[model samples]
Target: MRLSVAVCVPLALANWLLFSLSTMWADLEPRDLQFQSPLAWLALWANLLGIALLLAVLWRFGLEILEALAAAIKQLFAREVDWPAWFAELYAGLRPLPLFTLPAAALWGAWLVLFYFFDHPGGYATDVAFQIAAHALGACVYLPIFYRWRVLTKASSHDPQISG
Candidate 1:
């Protein structure tokens, strides 16, 4: 069960990326396009690199993810555990790292600017909106599981007094 939660992160990310990319690609045509500036290209690459690095890190630390998921699940269902504090700890622990933060900010800033300036066609606007929502949802689903794993491992190894 823990392993499944850990595995779901990458799987969900991959699915979201694939769906978003394919939809955006299909929306574009061979013509009727304007060339982007070098700065735009840099921003695009930076966002991509940042996301790839985030995913790589998560995948590499699969065991920790599993541990977190298990711990979270235990705390969530156990009436004796303070579920609110568990959530607070989870949020504090999973606060965005620089690797994820800068790139994510760049991506978000770019999207906001694009939405403000450009007039999207057909259901393009809706598609983009859904993509953004999907990204948020993915984070919502992954963070708690990851945080639980981190806290559980930390408590077991270094803080034996801590309990669920």
Candidate 2:
């Protein structure tokens, strides 16, 4: 989890910063824009690659990160928590739908709305800002569900009664 967070956060931030720089450059005259230079193009490709890497990291380690977070939270509140009761409740609340389905669908809907309906004067900066906002929103929604799923899965695995 520490590894996942260490990697994903920096990659996401780098992508955002690169897109911001590119957007700013788009405002300059074509002849003056540095983003047209080969180095800038390399940066642009790097940003794309960073995004892919970030997605891959999340796919590979997202659950592990969430599990670590849950464990930390549980440890932090150990004196106050009722472990058995908590696990019972979590298991009771388990749903048939996959954990990520709702959040992913909502994110997709948000992207569609932003792409088709939002007014942004057709500037690169606006597009970058929208992408950033979408990603932030996705993280906000995804993390909680991830944590919940992780906790439930871990609990069931540790206690065979929960699975039964």
Residues 2-104 of candidate 1 have per-residue lDDT tens digits of 3333444454455445434443444567584333566755655566677767666666774477457756576665434444545565555445333344444
lDDT of 1 at 98: 34
Per-residue lDDT tens digits for candidate 2, residues 24-128, read 575687677565567767867787777778677767886666556655665664324455544444344333224434444454445445544463356687667
Q: Ten consecutive residues with minimal summed lDDT in candidate 1?
A: 1-10
What does the lDDT come to for candidate 1? 0.53
The segments of candidate 2 whose C-alpha lies over 4 angstroms from its true place after superposition are 1-35, 79-118, 121-164
Specify the poorest-scoring 10-residue window by lDDT in model 2: 88-97
149 in model 1: Cα distance from truth in Å? Answer: 5.5
TM-scores of all models? 0.31, 0.42
